[model samples]
Target: MKNKLLLLMCILVFTTGCKKDFLVQEPLASFSDQDFWTSEASVRAFAMGYYKERFPGFGVNDVGGVFSIRETLNDDYASVSLPGFPSQPTVSGGGWATYFSDIRKDNIFVDRVSGMGMKLGDSATYKHWVGIARFFRAMDYCDFVFDYGDVPYYNRPLTDYDTALFRPRDPATFVLDKVLEDYTYAAQNVKLDDPGTGPRGLVITRDVVDAFMSRQLLYAGTKLKYDPATSAADRVKAGVYLQAAKDAAARLISSGRYAVADNYQKLCSTIDIGATPAVNKEMILYRRYNTGEVTHAIASGNNVNTIQGNGAPKDLVDAYLCTNGMPIKTTAGVNPAYLGDQTAANQLANRDPRLTNTFRTDRFYLQYIETGYSVTGYKCYKFLDEPTQNEAYAVQSFNITDAPIIRFGEVLLNYIEAAAELADMGTYTVVQSDLDKTINVLRKRAGYTAASRLPDMKIIGNLPAVGATVYDDADRDPSVPSLIWEIRRERRLELVYEGFRENDLKRWRKINYYNTQLYPKKNLGAWITKSSVTKALILADINGNVTSPSNTATGSGYLKVSQTFRNATSGFVVDRNYLLCVPTYQIDFYGRNGSTLTQNPGW
Candidate 1:
C-alpha cells in the first residue's frame, strides 16, 4: 500500500498580478468530487461506504461486538453495560449524531444518485445501485423513527444553502411514510437476483429489504395503534400498515427462497453463520467475517473464563414449551416435573430443546472454567464459543462467525403479529392457511414434528383461529390484549438473544415489565442450592455464594440478585423512555425561527 497527499493552494497576491493568480492542481489518487458521480462504477463505489458503516454482520473488525447480540438493553437476559451502562440513559442524555450522521450519508447518496443529471439507468438497466441507496435511506429513517420518535426528515443533499436542515422535526407518521416509500422502491427495483455485498455477496437483496420493512412496518403500526401519539383518525389506519407488514412477509414466503433451517441451535453456533448461510436460509441478511481480516470477540466473550455469566433467567427459560408442544409450567405433567426436579439438570431436561440449546444445563456446566461468567447463575449457551476460536491457543477476539441482521423467522413472527392485530381491529381475518406457512413451519423446524408446538394452530382446524382461543392469564397485564400477548410471547421465544426484546417492550408500550410492581424486582436470578452435585463447575463459585446458608438453598446453589445490573438504572421511566431523545444538534439546527426538532414526549 502507498500513501499520497495533494494540497491545492490558491494564493491571491495583493499586488498588481492578483487578477491572474489561481490554483490549477490535479488530485493525486483521489476522485474529483465534480466528476465522481458521472459514472455508474463511481456511484456504486459511494454506496459501498454506507454498508461499511451501517450494515451489521459479524464484527467487521471488532470481535464479540457483532450487531445482533445487542440483548444487553433488552429484558430477556440481563448483562452489565459498561463503557455504556446496561440500562437506559438519563432523560437529558442523548446518543449523539453518529447515528444521525450515518443517516445523513444515506440522504446525500440518495439525492445524488437520483439527481445526477441522468436517469439512474436505462430501461434495460434496473438501477441496482440506486435501489441499494434507497434501501439504506429507508433503514436510516427506520432507526431514527424507533430511537427518537419524530425526527427532521431529509431528502435533498446537505449544502451551505440548505434551509430545511434548520426546519422543525417532521411527524413520526410522515417520516414512516417516507421510509415505506424508500423500502417499496428498493423492493421493486433492487435486482432480486443481482446478488449483494461481502465476500459471498450474500448480505443485502430485494427480499432482505422486504423482511426489514416487515419488521419496521409491524413496529410502526403497533406503536401507532397502542401509543397515544396518533389521533383517533390516524389510529383507524393502524390495520393498513399492519396488513402491509403481513404482505411484505407474505411476498417473502411465497417466493419460497427463505425458510427456517431444521436445526435452530446451529444457526448461530460452531458451524459459523458465514460457512452455513446457505444451510441457514432463515437469515435473509447477515454480516460476514473473515478469519484474520475481519474478526470479532464474540468468541472471547463466550469463553468460560472471560464469559460474564450472562445467563438466561428463569423467567425466559420457562417460556419455552415442552417437547409435547405445551407450555412447560402450564400443564400438570411437565410443570410438576420442573418444580419437583431437585437438580437444575433434571429440570432443564423436561423443557424445550431450545431452552437447553440456549443455556448451559447440568452436564454441560462441567466444562465451565473456574472463573465464573454466568452472573445470573444460569449461564447463556446461546451463541456458543465456536470450536475454531475456543481453543487454548486461539485468540478469543478473533472468532469469525457471521452475525444476523434480518432473518426469515423474524418475518414470520412479524406476519402473525400483524395479522392478529389486524383481525382485532376488524381490518382482516387471519385464517389457518396463514399459520401453515408461518408459525407451523417454525414449530416443525424446532423438532416438534411429533407434536404441534402451538396447539392453537393445530386445534383450530375448522374454528375461527383468531377469536377461538382466549389467553386468560391472570398474571398478564390487563392493558395487553390476550391475542397480542400470545403473539408477543412467540416472538420473545423465537428471537431471544438476537436482540428483539427491548424494542418489543417499547412498541407494545409495556414499560411496566420493568415496573417492580408487576415483576419480581430487578436483578433476580435462578434458584440454586448448596451440597447439590449438579456439575463439576458448580464447585467453582458454588461455595462462595453460599454466604447466607442459614437463609436457605433450593437447587444447585442460590439465586443472587445482580448488583451490576441493579446500579445501572434508576428506572426505565415510562412514556419518556419509550423513545430516545433527539440528537441535540438536530434540535439546535432545526430549532431556528420557532422550529424545534422536538424532544420526544416527556424528555
Candidate 2:
C-alpha cells in the first residue's frame, strides 16, 4: 500500500496478464479483466497508475527524482567521481525488451478501453480514457525514439507466441508522426477539468496534455532541425512540428487556466503546493506526497549534513544573468551589476534572484570553503525546506515534499523558446508583446520589482537586446544566432537542475559541450581562497594528477576538483553519441525472426 490509488490502478497492469485459465479460477480478491473494465472508477484508477509509472515524484524514499539532483552527464555539474562520456560502444543488452514490456502495458490499456464502448457510461468519458492511454503510449514511444534513432512501433500488444514484436525498426520521422497523432487526439479529447477519485492535480487534463505536447514537440522540432542527418523534406516537417509546438504552448497561455503565481522556491519544496489557490495556480500536474503514504527523502540530499559530491559547476552558475538582464560576459563593456566571483557572497550579489533561490546563499550553509559538504561549493537547496533540515523526518527517507511534474513556469519558457525558434526559421516573428507575455512574465514572477524588472527582450538588428541595447556574449557558439543564444540562456537558467540540460544539449546537436578541452570551465567550480578553508582542499591538474593551488598566486582561484584529461580527446563521439545503440541481442533476435533490425548509424 505504497499509494492506495497508484497501487489500485497498477492492478490492471500486473493482474491482466495472467493465464486465461487463471482468470477462470479467479479468487474473491482477484480482479479479472472483465471485472476491472466495467466501472468508471476502475478506468480512472488504471490511468492513475501511469502517473506514478512515468512521473515518480521525487522518487520513492532516498532516491532522487527528476528535479532534486544533477547526477546526469551534462554541462551543469562537475565531479571527479562521475564517469566521463562514452568513447566507444559496447553490447549494452536488454533495453528494448524492458521498454517494450512497459509499452505493451499501455497498449493493453488502449485496446481494452477502446473496446469498452458504452460500458464506462458516456462517449466523452470513453474517449477521455482512450486519450489517456494514447497519451502515455505516445510518450513512451517518444522516449524510445530519443534513445534509439529508429524504434519498432507497436500499436497493439502482441501475444507471447506472436513474432510480430520482433519487427524491424520504424523510421524516426514515422514514429514521431504517430506520436503527433496521439498527442493531437489527447489534447483534443481529454477533459479540461477532470475531478477523479484523488486530489485536484493528479489526473491528466487537456492542459497537462498540451503542456507535455509543447515540450515533446519542441524537442522533436529542434532535434530534427539541427541533426545533420535529417533530410530536406524532414527539415520542412521540423518547421511544421515547431509551429505545432508554438501553438500547443499558445493554447495554454491563451486559456489562462494556469499562471506563474506561486513562490518560486516553495513550488518545488513544499509538501502540498495544491493546498492554496495562489500557490497551485502555477502547478499544472504535481504528485502529492503524503507524510505516511508516499513520502521521499529528496530534502535530505539537500540538507546540511549531506555532501553533494556532484555540485553545480561554474558553467551553469555563469549562465544566470545579472539583475539588469544583461550577461556577465557581454562584448558591450562590463555589466556593473556583476560583482565578480572571488567569493560566494560577491558572486551571489546583483545576480538573478533564481541564482540565490537555486543555491545556498546563506553564509552559515555556504559550503564553498568546506569541501566535504559540496565538491563545487555551489550547493543547491532549491528543493530543501530550511525549517525541516534538522527535523527527524528530514534525516530519514520520508521527507514529504511534492514534486512539480508540469507547471506554468516551464510552459512559459517552452512557449518563448518555440516562438523564438520559429522566428529564427523565418516562419514567425517574435515581437515585444510575445516577450512581455512570456519571458518577461517569468522574470516578474522571479521576484523582480517593478522598477528593477528586466527590460523586455527584443530582436534588434538580428541581435538579442535588452530594450534597445544589444549585447553580445563572447562565449556564444558562432553558428547559433544571437537571439537563439539568449533564448537558450533563459531556458538553461529557468530549468537548471530540473533534469533538462542533458536533453537540451542533445536536441541542439551540442553534446560536444561536455568536452572539457573545448570548455575547461565545465570542470571548474566556485572561486575561493585557500586560507579560508580549514579542511584539506584537493584539486587535480590538467593531467588529472593530484596537485595543489599555485603557491605564487596566494591560493586564490577556482576550486578545480576534477580534471577530465582523457575526455579532452575522446569525449562525446559526434558520430554516435546523440542516438544510443540498440542492444546487440535485440538485433540478433530480429535477425533470428527473419526481420532486419538495423543498428543506428555509427553505433
Candidate 3:
C-alpha cells in the first residue's frame, strides 16, 4: 500500500512551529517509543513530521514563515520602525535550544533503524528512511552553526544519566564537517523519487537532498571564508565545501530532473501548487496547501486591497536592472528609457519585468478594504493572486496558495554563487558556459524575450555588459570586484522579499550594507507626489531632517518613515553582530552541569 493516510497525518501537523531544542521535545507517542521499527510505513510517517517542523511553509494562521514574510532586518524592507538588530544576549534562550528536540528525534530514529528491527543494511528502503532522518539532523546543525557559530554536537539521543549531555561546544568547522557527512549520505543513498508515488515532487528525494545540501554547503563554505574569527587552517577547508556545493548543484543540473519550467508569477502565487507535473516542474520540493485542509496567511497578508504595513525599499528597487539590461545608475548612461523615480509609474517604467511582477504597479497609489494602504507608496504583490484578493477565501488564515520549500530557481542561484565564490578563492575560473547554465536561464524565465534577453554575464576581463559596452554600477561597493558585484545584484533582484537578503549580506561579510550611514537608501521608500496622496506623508532626507514641501514648489519626495524610526539606532555593529550571542541561560545551564558553554566574542 502507498500509505496515502501519511499525507493527511503530515498536513494535520502543519500548524506546529519548529521547536528550538531536543531537551524540550516529547518523543513520538502514538507511533510508540518501543517497536518503532515495526514497519516502514510508521518510519515514513515519522520522517514526514520533520517536513512540518523544519519547513513551516507559509506558516500557521495569521503568522508568516518562509514565504513573503517581512525581512525588515535586511535592506529589502522599509517601514515606520526599523526592525531591531541583535545587540545583546538574553537571559532566557533565544530559541537556540529548540533545534535539539528535533536533533534528538533524528538521532533516535537513526539509532533504532540501524540497530533494531530494520537492521536490513543493504535494503534500499532501510537506507532511504535512515538517510532522510540524518539529512534533517544535518539541516538542524546547519541552522545551529549559522546562528550560534559554535554549538554542542550530538549524534545520539541522550539520557538523564548520560555525561555527554553536558559536552562543551564543538568548533564550527568540526560541526559543519559532520553536517556535510550526513548530507552526503542522504544525497548518495536516498531514492531518486518517492517509492510511494514516483516523481510526485512532494516527498524527500535525492534531488531535494542535493538542492538543500548545496545551499547549506555554500553557507558553510562562505562563513569560513569570510568570518574573520575563522582560524587559518579552518579557512583552507572552505574550498573543499565550495567544491562540494558546486558538485552537488552540477549533479542536479546534469540529472535533468527539474528545470525553470514555470513563469515568475505563476510559480509564486498558484493554488494547490504541487503534485501535478505542470506545477511541480520547477519545484524540487514544495508544501501543498489544500483549501480547508492546511492553509496559511501569506496570501492574505499580500492582498492588494489589504493594508500591508511594510514595503520593498528603494535600495532593493534600485537593484532591479533596467529594461535595457543595465543598472539604472551606470556611469555611461546606457539605459535612456529609464524614467526618474519621482513617482511609482515613472520609477517602474522600462525596468526589469520582475519589478512589475513583484510590486503591484496599479495599486502604488491606493485602494481599500475599509481604507487600505502600504506604509511605503510601493506595494508588493509578488505572492498575491489578483483573482482572490477581495474574496473571503483569501482573508487571514484561510489562504490556500502553496508554498515552495525548495525550487530549481534557488538551486540555480546557489550554483552560480558557489561557483563565483570558488573562482574568487582562486580554485578555478568561471567561464561563460557557467553563466549560461545558471544565471541566463533564470533571466529567460523572468519574462525576457530571445531578442531582449539580458546580456550573458562575462567573466574574463569583462563584467556584466549591455550590447557591446561594459559598464559599472555607480553605487557598487568599491571593496567588491565588479564581476562579483553584478552577480550579487542579479541575485538581489531575483530573490528579493523571499527572506534571503539578511543571510546573503552576512555570508558575503557585507553586513554593513544595512548601515544607514553607509547606504542611506536602506531607510528610504518609494517616491511619491506628496500633494496628490490623501494620507498625511512625512518626507525626510538622508540626514533625518523632516522637509516640508514649499508652498511655491510641487510637493514631491520619498516616504521617510524608517529614517525617523532608525534616526538614533546604531545599525550593524560589525564585530559583535555577525553571529548571535549564546543566551545566558544556556551558559548558566552548562555551568550548573559542571561544564562551560563559552559565549560568542564581544557579547
Candidate 4:
C-alpha cells in the first residue's frame, strides 16, 4: 500500500498539465512501471517538467509566482498596511514543506535516470538530463537557505520521509556549499541550447545554468563578504565564491550570444514572445504563456483594466535618470514645480524613457483608484502591455505574456557587482571598461549617451571587525566608491519590482530602505494639488467611485503609503526582522524533544 501510494504520487508529479505546460513533456508509458526509465523521450520530458514546476509560470493568483511576496513589502510598491519587522513572528510558512514534493521528484529523476542506459540519445544528450535535475535541486536549496536559514541537506529522494524528516538543520555554509556544488556541475554539463526552437527558449541550457549560478553565487558571496551575521572565517572565504561568481558571469558574457536588446519592455510582460521569440533574444529563459495553454496574471497585476494598482514609490520614480543621463534627484526636488503639478505626466517629464515606459502618468485610466490596492497617485507599467492588457481584455486567462525568468541583463549586473564588491573586499580595482561591459551598456540600452562616464568607487571602510553596524557615510551604507553606488542605483532602476528588490534589500542589509527615515516624513507619491482630478482622486476607486475621500486632500505634494514601516516605533524591530519567524509548533514537532530543528534567531 505504501509503495502503491508512492507510485500514485510519483505519477501525479510527472503528470504535466496540458494547459499549464510551457515546455510540455510527453508521458512515459504507464508512469508506475519500471520501464518509465527506458525511453529517452520520457527522461527529456521529466527534465522539462523540472523547469515547469521549479520556476513555475504564474497565473493571476498563484503562490510562489505572481502575487508571491505581496509586493508592498519592498521600497518600490505601496500597500495599505505597511510591513514591519515582527517582534514575535511565529510559524513562518516553512518554504521546504511546500517544495518537498518538487525536491522528491527532482531527486528521483537524478537517481533513477542517471544510471539507466539511454537508447534514443548519445551520452552527451543524457548528461543534459542529469544537469537539469541537479539544477532544480540546487535551485530549491538556494531558495531554501534564502528563506529558512538552514535545512537538512538531502541529495536523494527520501522514500521513508517520516523517519528521515527530523534530520537536524545544517549550517547555512554547508547548504550553500552544496548549492555551489550542484550549480557547478550543472553549468559544465547542461546542454548548450535546447534541441530545437520549440525548446530552445524554455529548456534548461548552459547559459541558463551560468546565469543562475552567477545570481546565486553573487548573493551567497555578498552575504558572506559583508553581513555581520557571517563569521570571520566565512568572511575570509567570501572571495573564493565572489571570484567564482565573476567567472561564471564572465563565461556567458564572453560568449557574446546574449545582449541587452533595444527594448527593455519586450523582456517583460510581452504576449509577443510566443509569436516572435526571436525579437526577445536578450531573454535567456522566459516562461511561455499561451492563452488557452499556459497563462499568468502579470498583466492584471500591473495594468489599469484588472487593477492591481501597486503604485511605484516616489523614491523609485526619482531613481530614473534624466534625459541628459543625470540623476533626476540632482535636478528635480520636492518643490513647487516638480511636486506641485499634481499631474502624472508633469511628474515624469524630463526623466528617463524608462520612467515613462515604466509608470502610468497623469492620464487617469478611469478616474477610478483605490487606496488599499496601490500607492495613491502612481501605478506600475513595467509588466503591462497595452491593447491586450485592457478591460475589453485578451482572454479568460487574462494574461498570456511570456515572463522573462532570467535575462542576460541581470548576468551583466551580477558580474559587475561581484567584481566591484570584490574590489572593495580586496586589492582588485574595478575600472571603467567593467562599467562599459555592464552598467554603461545598460545605460545605452536605456537610450543614454557616453558622457555618463561613471564615477569611481571608494571603500567606506568604517565597519568594525565584529559588532553592530554603523555608517559615518551619508547614505548610511558601507561607503564604497561613487561608481559602486551608481551601479547599485542602476540595478535598482533596471530591475524594480521584478522580484529582485526585496532580496536586494535583505542581502545588502539595506533594511532601512523600507524604514521611514529615508522619506522626509511620509511615504510620498507624485506631487498633487487640489484640482478636478484631485477631487476625483480623493473620491475614486479603480471603478471611478467616490466613496471616501481621505489622505492628502490639501493643495500639497505627492501621494504616500503610511509612515509605518520606516518609523522605528511602528512595530518594526531591527535585527529580529532579518529572518522570518518559523512556527513554534513545527519547531516543537520537528525538534521532537531533541535539538534538531533550531529556529531562526529572534523568531
How does each model score on TM-score? 0.83, 0.90, 0.89, 0.80
All-Cα superposition RMSD per candidate: 5.8, 7.3, 9.2, 9.7
What is candidate 1's lDDT per residue for 1-603, written digit by digit as tens? 122222212122334245643244454565666667776667756866666556655454443333334446555654333112223333333454665577778877876777664444563233566677888888878777777777778876677676565766677788888888888888888766643234323656678778888998898888888887678766865666787788898899899888787666666654356556444677776666665467665545555555554555446666665454445444123344354334666667656566666666763332233364465556665566445545542345566666666788888899988888888787777677777777767776744445323344442532223235422333345676655665676788778777677778888887656542234423345554443333332211222243333323223533433433222145444567777765455566555545655666654
Report every candidate's CA lDDT: 0.61, 0.77, 0.75, 0.64
Candidate 2 lDDT by residue in tens digits, 168-208? 78888899999999999999998887876555577788888
- Which has the higher TM-score value, candidate number 1 or candidate number 4? 1
Task: Please estimate how well model 2 matches the true structure, expressed as its whole-model Cα lDDT.
Answer: 0.77
Which predicted model would earn the best TM-score? Answer: 2
Q: Model 2 clash pairs?
A: none
In candidate 3, what are the lDDT values of residues 382-474, reduced to their tens digit? 887788777776887888788788888788888888888888888778888888899888877734565445556555554666556678888
Clashes of each: 17, 0, 10, 18
Ranking by lDDT: 2, 3, 4, 1
Give candidate 2's error at residue 388 in angstroms. 2.3
Segments of candidate 3 deviating more than 4 angstroms: 1-32, 117-122, 197-199, 275-278, 366-370, 446-453, 532-535, 541-545, 549-554, 563-574
Q: Candidate 2 regions off by >4 Å?
A: 1-31, 86-94, 363-372, 450-452, 532-535, 538-554, 566-574
For TM-score, candidate 2 versus 4, the one ahead is 2
Measured on C-alpha atoms, candidate 4 has an lDDT of 0.64
Question: Which one is best on lDDT?
Answer: 2
